[model samples]
Target: MDAQLKHGLLEVCVLTALYKEDSYGYRIIKDTSPFIKISESTLYPILRRLESGNYLSVYSVEHNGRLRKYYKITDLGKKKIEEFLDGWDEVMNIHNYIVTETRRNENE
Candidate 1:
């Protein structure tokens, strides 16, 4: 995927993952892997950005005597996701236009 496209999609994906449940960095990577390729390098900055944006909140829990940082979606995050979903229709429409237009021109 293009870097720019992936950047935005990844942010939404991260938010959605937190929406499902609060999770730490590695867990977020694991959860998102089924849908999108996410690694520590890719995920950390996104997490930081979301936390900074107030879309996510972070807290640390001691697990196995280690501190694990967990992320939870905020009200702002939910609102943002709704906005993304609402805007998705336009994206799908543009995709449909490209696909059908390409096919039509090809058949001609």
Candidate 2:
């Protein structure tokens, strides 16, 4: 996958992970892993970028005698998810076109 495209998808995936409930770093990775493989190294930067963009909010909670950061999707983040869903048809159209083009030679 293109790094830029993957980067955007990863950001959205992280937001989706927090859609239902706020979560810590490890849980976010575990939750998102089913849809897309994400390592700790990859997750932290996405988290930071999302936080910086005001798409999500971060708060520290006491867990196991330590502070663990939990991320919650903000209104903007939720809106972003809705927007992505709205634009999904366009993505699917592009995907369908690519698939057809790739298989055209085989069909010939």
Candidate 3:
């Protein structure tokens, strides 16, 4: 995938994960693991970017004598997700065209 596009998608994915409830880093990674395997290295930078963008808010809570930072999606972040979803049909159209072209070439 294109790096820039992948970055934006990942940002939206993270936002969706926090849509229902606030989550900590480890839990977010674990929850999203089924679809994407994100390591701590990748997640923290994304978190920082989201925080800086005001897409989410971060707060530290005491967990087992340590501070665990949790992320909550903001209205702007929710709108970002909605915006991405609004364009889903175009992406599906492109995907279908690529598949059809690839299969047509194979049958030639």
lDDT of all the models against the reference?
A: 0.93, 0.92, 0.90
Report how far residue 106 has shifted in candidate 3, in Å.
Answer: 1.9
Candidate 3 structure quality by residue, lDDT tens digits, 30-105: 8888877678898889999999999999999999999989999999999989999999999999999999999999
Clashing pairs in 2: none
| lDDT, ranked from best to worst | 1, 2, 3
What TM-score against the true fold does each predicted structure earn?
0.94, 0.91, 0.89
Task: Pick the winner on TM-score between candidates 1 and 2.
Answer: 1
In model 1, residue pairs whose N, Cα or C atoms come closer than 3 Å (at least 3 residues apart or on different chains), thus clashing, are: none
Better of 2 and 3 by lDDT: 2
| Per-residue lDDT of candidate 2, residues 1-108 (tens digit) | 788888879989999999999999999888888789899999988888999999999999998999999999999999999999999999999999999998997799
Which stretches in model 1 have alpha-carbon errors above 4 Å? Answer: none
What's the true lDDT of residue 20 in model 1? Answer: 78
Q: Return the top candidate by TM-score.
A: 1
Error of 3 at 64 (Å): 1.6
